[model samples]
Target: MPTILMRYRAAALLGAAVIIAPLSVAAFSAHNVAAAAPTLSASPNTGGSFAPIVSADKPAVVTVTTVIKAENAGDEEASPFRGNSPFDEQFRQFFQDQGIPMPDQSPEPRQGQRAEALGSGFVVSADGYIVTNNHVIDKASGITVTLDDGTQLPAKLVGADPKNDLAVLKIKPSKPLATVGWGDSDALRVGDQVLAIGNPFGIGTTVTSGIVSARGRDLNSGPYDDFIQIDAPINHGNSGGPLVDAQGKVVGIDTAIYSPNGGSVGVGFAIPSDQARKVVATLMKDGSIEHGFIGVQIQPVTADIADAIGLGQPEGALVAGVNGGTPAAKAGLKAGDVINAFGGSPVKSPRDLSRMVADLSPGTSKSLSVWRTGQSRDVPITIGRNTGDQQ
Candidate 1:
């Protein structure tokens, strides 16, 4: 949806993370300090029956159905054969008079001529809070959630962080809803077992198993795109579903898949839970996140660029451009300056710097370790908020 990346939103097996909070990242009251939500994890040694894990987590997974206006749905199949629809009702008569017998074809269900967009989500709180991809409900006129027990409920959008492609919805269930616990995604290694549960192609809930194919996959979707790559066969309608770990805890949020042929080719991506925890917690309070920003364009410091700049080694982020009146400019940061560190932590790459700056709160002051003119120096700066107005 955002380039060749197919967003597993709507009805296709294609689509489309960093973007992780490090230890130094600010903390939040993500959840109340109470008893942990009951997560029924099955014995990993159970010799191949994931039924227990599925049974425990399935209750928390819900199907997210969204309704978009016809004009924006981009799914009009009026049929060129008809020679009418957008043309005119009068054209239909004219085309009919030509006696062009239409071939026998079953009428396409107006499939939401209102554009019914289907995706998946999971219950994160017993109080009825849900997490899904922003693309799932993007531009939707109405949203509905169907629980595991077949109970349908109208949902309200609590908040959405589109930069992360994550949205939080609130539904009022008659009783406390079943919930899933967050898992540590950082601990997952290649070949570690994981399960993806969701409604692929609007088919009833299904579960697929695979190993962690890779990690830190950046699809160039965005700067905060540190993704968990898995060969779990996620397809359309799996967007926003939870990627569960062996312990039955939610480790990642299924968001996109890699498919050049319009279906899963054993490659899928999910947002790490560590990052989602902070964003979701904030969304639960504020309607959106005020991401930290400093008007500076950056690129990785390749070895050639580093040598030319007289740096000891290829490292840190090189300032390519600095916006005027922005924090970087105000701090006297100029092109050719290499940001080696922030808040005393090494700024290893552009992606690293991106996640670092984004983790800080606006107005929070920090010192940047800058390598300029063959010398290292510290430039103090105040983090600014990216209000979509400022660069």
Candidate 2:
């Protein structure tokens, strides 16, 4: 077996042994000698740590169910075609003699609960403000927030930004709501320990532990694509719950998991709390987000292009087009100029520049340093509103 698989199996065996050993102690203690039985540790453990954290955060982790009206009877249609076996593809000519149809229809949506699809959410503020995935509550006509203690309250949509896949909801709880502190997601490194606490598969609050598998993973979810990837088991209903560190401070929101069988294969993605914080704040204050733009369409500088442009190495964004009459054009930033830095921050690629520009304030002036003709020049340009389709 592979080394990683062997290690996983060994760890699983160890966990099972630890939990089952205590039960056999009484059986052995029944002997005539009546020796003291091996006692289980009474102190807190990792698996059981979920209980304490869940108990404390349950009030903030609300069960979110979405209701949407649809016309189609929603069950997904089954595919009528079958894949060729391992050796079947080798004999395609023989099989082609027989008629076979390829699977080619769009899947039908599932039909059943038009009333609700279970998910999770977390309170971000004391004023009964909550943050959840845009999908969890999208197209929901009447949202009801069900507390951990069984209190159901009406909730209103504060604002939603589909680009980030996040939404803010408001509810008037009877008392101050429990809120989790946001941790510095930028400080998280791959292999750092992490925890995921949420309601999974409609089960009560459950917790799972794992480590940061990756960082800044771009799943093509949005323009500001910076996801903190974790190995924690985040299931269907786990979306929108907090991915906290060992300190119980939330570093990311449990957003997505990659599964072919609808079960965790140890791959999961979360929106970094730092980005979510900015989105949530903007949604709360302005009811909509306005991102900054530099009016430059850019591409990644390749080795050949870098050499042609007199760059020592291939790094930074290659400008492809500049919007007419925009700040970048007015600042003499022409096509083919490689932007190396913005506001003293290095621009690694097109996405890096896109994110940095989006995070900037519209109408604010920012400096751009570019490399051209074996020379570097810094140009100041006033940021402009991004009116085009945003990611």
Candidate 3:
């Protein structure tokens, strides 16, 4: 098997990044205002201690608390037997005739139950823009950010990109807020020293130290599944926290951890800062991102399949199925064909192609290199709006 494809079987990405104990979602609200792109800066840590970096960046890191509405709860109290049906009324009447005391039938003001949850986030701009995971504030009825000084402020959703598992939040503060700058995730190498800071289990802010274990990990969460794998002990409430480097710059966002038990097992996944910076910039400006979609089911070309098709290498994404009336179908991309390159970029695996395609904007036209019938050819195609990212 190809080494790239083997990673999927070796260990699942933590969405393939999983949180054994899921962080609570269900908070909600959107703000009409948008902020400009974030300003980036970093103060390197020279001392052996992580104290300097922490001291510089910790102020920007925050605890995200959310009040989410319970979907199962209702607005008013009603008898359990009083369901929405004529038969339910008859059943209640029957119970009344039997001299049985039924549950309360009188309507009372039963407010929708709200669940409180905690996670972590970091300020990206001095103007009060914050970066966190989409899952952190997903479905929240209200959101709050607690600063390091213990000041709490209301937060509003600016925009969210679930495919990337990221969201942007806005808070109007009285003054400029402390901010952590973005670092180059592409520069991160395996074994590089790093720090994971967050409010694990909602017990205030905590910091963990580790190295970048791996890069370009596909958790299989979605099309844009590339993540940085780390050995830091990121836990439940660390969901949207920042993964910093010795340079004191934000390099990744702690998202999920792989554990059979509900704790960190030395396996954690983070959204690369390079990716997050782009998404955050777009969200702050446009309020959302529209991923490009091509309607096709794909799988990595295994060695066996490669040999069968006389392909010298098991690389690129193999077309498994194509949805009709979609971009792939319209481009005459057929089953059994292999997509070796997309928009001039080499496709090393299905994951690579997925990430590449999703990075494209809808209505953008690009050339796709296809291998078919013992030959290769380039095909022109236009990207389509992703009504859904499944394509």
Candidate 4:
């Protein structure tokens, strides 16, 4: 595996680079303060200004190596010569055509195959906290993190959220660690320049630059799939590394790419820093995140459904089904009820409601405003943990 970050195809070509969209940076710079003048001998060394942000973050990036132990053989593995296997009919036809006898299936099982994979991660805290993609460590019995200095450490799983494809890790580093500063991902706009740093294909730490192609993108990672789409070069080993902005702050975590040839396609996906930080915090503090549930399967009311319901315009999430004893059902919520408000946040669509519920604290009661039977009313529902058993 290469450890360097892959280069974006479009941006690297020098001709296909997209326009950089102007972003609102006022809010992001609101906390900037002027430093007091130094009293004596020499001027303090101010951090050098830079355009790409991955300059200082490279040290915090690490290469993750995983070992998979597989069984050598199965007790009773299915034979390729039997049943619906393509080789079954071919074997039978071959014997019939060539006038040769076919061998009987053996009772013994076949041998198994083992595979090893590599990925990347970034340090988020100096105390040995790291973040990476859950899929990178999935089913991995052993994991090792290799720093830039050739130092290797055994990492333990702090917590993992498969729904969002994220995992938290803790390494027992004997020395102080370098960590990346978090950025305001919400402040990033489409076309903003970004830098991606990671170990791609087991290569040493590599840095690639590109622009944010889009924001609030949904790659079906989960209900809260608001990702930042970038035209950065991201490959197999880039998963879980930081997507830094121009200020050397981590704005996102590189996760996936839209590719058919198993290579960079100039379209990479990353989890926003805002959302990732929340997951990291929950994993660090409570070892798990407690998701809020509204207990209703809602769909955005379309024109047809709105007309059928006699509503003048289509809006809000239409309750398609309600859990029998869930909080929504207990609050008199029924199918066809249009949810317009969750707590005080506007509910524009199913995704909106899903985000609202997920961001709320579990067991906390929230107010919902719904339109039903030509009337709007408020209903209270106590949010519940997802528990992985319910929608």
Return the top candidate by TM-score: 1
Q: Is candidate 1 or candidate 3 better by lDDT?
A: 1
For candidate 2, the 10 contiguous residues with the lowest summed lDDT are 17-26
Q: What TM-scores do the predictions have?
A: 0.81, 0.74, 0.78, 0.75
Error of 1 at 150 (Å): 0.5
Query: Candidate 4 residues 8-47, lDDT tens each?
Result: 2211121111111000111112122122221111121236
The order by descending TM-score is 1, 3, 4, 2
Off by over 4 Å in 4: 1-52, 71-114, 303-313, 389-391
Candidate 2 lDDT over 1-391, as tens digits, reads 1432243233222210000000000011111212222221122235646555545545567766454443211321111111211112322332244443222222333444233444578766655677787656655666666676667778888887766767777788767666666677889999988778776655566678999999987644336777787898876567678887665667888876644444577877788887787777777666777778877778889999987878987989998988788878888998889998999999888888888888776888989999877899998988888776331
Which stretches in model 3 have alpha-carbon errors above 4 Å?
1-43, 72-112
lDDT at 251, model 4: 85
Error of 1 at 368 (Å): 0.6
For candidate 2, what is the TM-score?
A: 0.74
Cα lDDT of candidate 1 equals 0.71
Worst 10 residues of 3 by lDDT: 20-29
Model 2: pairs clashing at backbone N, Cα or C within 3 Å: 74-109, 74-110, 74-111, 75-111
